[model samples]
Target: MTIDESALGFGSGARAVWASDPEKSRGRLHAEETSRTRSEFQRDRDRIIHTTAFRRLKHKTQVFVAHEGDHFRTRLTHTIEVAQIARALARALRIDEDLAEGVALVHDFGHTPFGHTGEDALDELLKDHGGFDHNAQSLRVVTQLERRYAAFDGLNLTWESLEGLVKHNGPLTDESGNGLDGPVPQPILDYCARQDLHIATFASLEAQVAAIADDIAYNTHDIDDGLRSGLLQLEMLEEVPFLCELLREVKDRYPELEQSRMIHEIMRRQITLMVEDVIAVAQAKLAHLKPRNADDIRSAGQAFARFSPDLQDADRSIKSFLYANLYRHPDVMRVREQAAGIVRDLFDAYVRDPSLMGGHWRTGVSGFDEAQICRRVADYLAGMTDNYAVKQHRTLFDRTPDLR
Candidate 1:
């Protein structure tokens, strides 16, 4: 059965507002007839939940190494927090909550083991083979890497969701030019188009919300972790003029705030402030336009724009502080170096000889070549927890016997 243009989500007006072509239908699933019916956004959410990438987040690092503390936030927990914040903002703004949730859940699904440290190592190692980027890798994973389904090669996510994964940076840069710092050139535009497979331009408003929420979650949570790790003092935040002022304002409003409660309250306040700013900016742009028809409602300038400059600058400051105070501390760097060595060594061993790989990897002989071997080795290293990677490293280099 063919879907009429009118019956679909986008109408004539939507087509005009969109910078690119509207998303095309990818054929309906036969199982939808018998299984409980879900909205398109809900299906996106469910698909992310069941994917191996999503599950692997459980073992991936958030800030500290995965084995540092059992209760510390893993990549999975961070994703959940970002999703919760994104869903709250989406519902408040009448956006598709499920779509926001889905984007938030899988945003970091491509993160390598040992968190950003491992990602950096992979980038250095694979510079010749198209430098490894988590965002680009994310698109590759959902589009081609995953092998769960017999019918499709990937999770077969919706175009909107995939776009969210790639274009989450908002109006930062076109991939060639440094974001906000460099002039937009033709070369930059061309590079942006080719940077990632799914995104050729800026993200939608909903995707931008997810991106901002990720910033909010990490900024607040990382500070919390730093305090817990005894690396950062709440008082030291006062050294930074803007952060000091913000903290002072927050404390003045809520005098009963404790260290434990302060993080949650500060995050809540920042999110509300940012959401209101986003809505105001969006509405200001659409204020002059009059809706011609039903299509006009969806076509308004609601999908453009990004978090205000003030917010972006503030977020950058927070990220810098976290990197200096926590992420790059000697304690953290030591573990990161150790993890990177493990990944590098493992990649070297497997890529040199695929026969060393056990289980399902051994069965495929002619089909398994160098590129395939690299991916399999990457898969093994990427799936490891911090302790597991260390143990594997010991087994390979220290002549420790493999119990498994």
Candidate 2:
């Protein structure tokens, strides 16, 4: 069966451009030519939803650790928010919502446990072996790590989805500007290129939209979390010039707001302003291209610019506050240091010899292999919650449960 062009959201103008693509009619899977229950893009979305990495996000951190509170956002929740914001932007700009949402959902699948802190430790440990990057790890997870299907080792996602994952930022060009354009220098690009799939030309405008949405979500939500944790005061924000101006505007319009309600209102306003900035830039850039199909949209010149200078300064101010007052606070720093120690120790133990690991380590035949053993240890450490990591550290290293 072939794709029903009419079922897609691309309007007549876009449809005219989409119909010209040869691959549009091809089924999602090469093996099952007769099965056509889902469009290629839809299949991408479904595959991600069912993946181990996507499910593991529920245990990963957003800002605070995952187990701090049930109400706190997990990596999974953040991915959902990014997808929601991306889909909204895609709909507004007449791009592919399915592709946008698919990319957003899988963007953080490679993040290690304990958030960025764990990632830093792992990167240092693996520095001699080509280093570790969450983005590249994400590609590895889909392509090799996950062992679900016997028919294929990886998820076997579509070329478009893979491209979106690697080059979501844009095409990689050379310093000379005259050289041929290429995909970004990430490991995912190397893997895809080795397999002979077209490397992502550049991230589609929709992917850029997702990236912006991520920035908006994290910036605003980090502030919200900081304020809620009592590390930042409303009065302090009210005195910070640019943030002061924004807070004043919120107060004038949202009087009587308090707590989470007030914070959500402030975040909503900030996100709306960011979205407006994106819309303005995109409209201006796309005005000349007249792009109507997904390929054209992806290949069009850059659709958005960096944050305005004013916004960038304000963002830096917010980041500074978070770094100095929230992230570096004694309590937070203590936990992060402890997590780093746990990760390092675990890596050392497993990398030296897999036989040292206690539970479940003795089962798998592959456990004796150093690389496989290191990965298993990493997985075990990664599956830990913040408190669990602390407990395990105490249990194994400190020699007492009540030492604290």
Candidate 3:
């Protein structure tokens, strides 16, 4: 098969000057022959979809436990949503759609079971050794943990994909190599030593689109899920003025609409509004910045893809309301506490006896020191789905907390 350049969107004059050119990709950490039929970004997306870690997302929690309700969004569904929005944004911005979609698909691969609760538990357990960051774990997953390839342990994704995965949320360090937010995750720093991801600069415009897509997807879907879970009522949404206006519009348009349809309509409108806002903002920013190429985007010193100021304020308002009324609600917090316990218990159990972990995971772990053992245990636990973690907890301990 020969490379189909035109089919890869390169032939289309629509692609912007700043769009990532797969032909000029920085290349993968491990040298591999180029695909005859696919662009590097397309190959990256396909590799991500076939990973064991990607499949595990089906049973991982988003805002609700995977087993709680079939209707709730799991990590897989959320990733799909993010990918959809990211592709849409990429198309609108005339960037590399495949790279944006791939980044969105793999962004949450590092999340532990039970969402933030499990992450918190792992972070606390590893505080002494070096704290756990899901973002760092995500990089570790694609670069080091996965063992499917013949030559490399991880997926051996392209440099662009790896850069997007690690820095989708933005640069981790400043000019002085100091952490931008806090201490850069040890896993990230360690990986940078071997293969420099240029931790100080922004990722490609493709990655920025993926990052904002995540914000748009989660914000819209969480509210939809909250409504389904009865944790958030239509009336409660009025607390956020932006949402209140949306509610008013929905009611005024379809006064006779049923509850479920009304909720869906509101969600549709919310997603549309946010996505459009992002496109408009990004277009204006791109015009002002006039970036000549993908590298220019990285050095632009500000995010080119984001909500406008008014929408950003609205986004914050919606987030605050969700935090107060849904995330920290008595019922959700109770479940979070129970879920955190399961993670904590599992970590302690594995740390005490590495033999208790799967045979594949325990291989050569006996020679490792305490910190190494803890990290190994953390990695094993981090990969588990909510149901698997619960099952392991049941098998290991006599009593397990009821997540419900």
Find the candidate with the highest TM-score and give its number.
3
Q: lDDT tens digits, residues 1-404, model 3? A: 12222323333557889999999999988899998999999999999999999999999999899778999999999999999999988887889999999999999999999998999999999999998999999998998898898998899999999999999989999999999999999999899898899999999999999999999999999999999999899999888888889899999999999999999999999999998788878777877789999999999999988888899999999889889988999999999999999999999999998999995898898689999999999999999999999999999999998798
Task: Give the TM-score (vs. native) of candidate 2.
Answer: 0.80
Error of 2 at 316 (Å): 4.2
Candidate order by lDDT, decreasing, is 3, 2, 1
Off by over 4 Å in 1: 1-36, 170-198, 250-258, 286-305, 362-372, 399-404
Task: Flag clash pairs in model 2.
Answer: 171-202
lDDT accuracy of residue 64 in candidate 2: 74
**Candidate 3: stretches off by over 4 Å:** 1-13
Better model by lDDT: candidate 2 vs candidate 3? 3
lDDT value for model 1: 0.64
Model 2 regions lying over 4 Å from their true place: 1-35, 171-186, 196-200, 239-242, 292-313, 355-404
Residues 1-404 of candidate 2 have per-residue lDDT tens digits of 12233333434334224221325623333354423676666777888999877887887767677556677777888899888887766665656667778889988877876788888898788765545677777777777667678787668777666666766766555334332443343465568555533443555565677777777777777777777777678777764566677788878887887767877777788887766566555655555576666567655555452366567777788777778877787877776766677778767865665555656654584525554555566655654544555565665574422211
Q: lDDT tens digits, residues 114-144, model 1? A: 7887778876776555456677667667766
Weakest lDDT window of 10 consecutive positions for candidate 1: 1-10
lDDT scores in order: 0.64, 0.66, 0.92
Cα RMSD for candidates in order: 7.9, 6.0, 4.4
Candidate topping lDDT: 3
* Model 1 clashing residue pairs (backbone): none
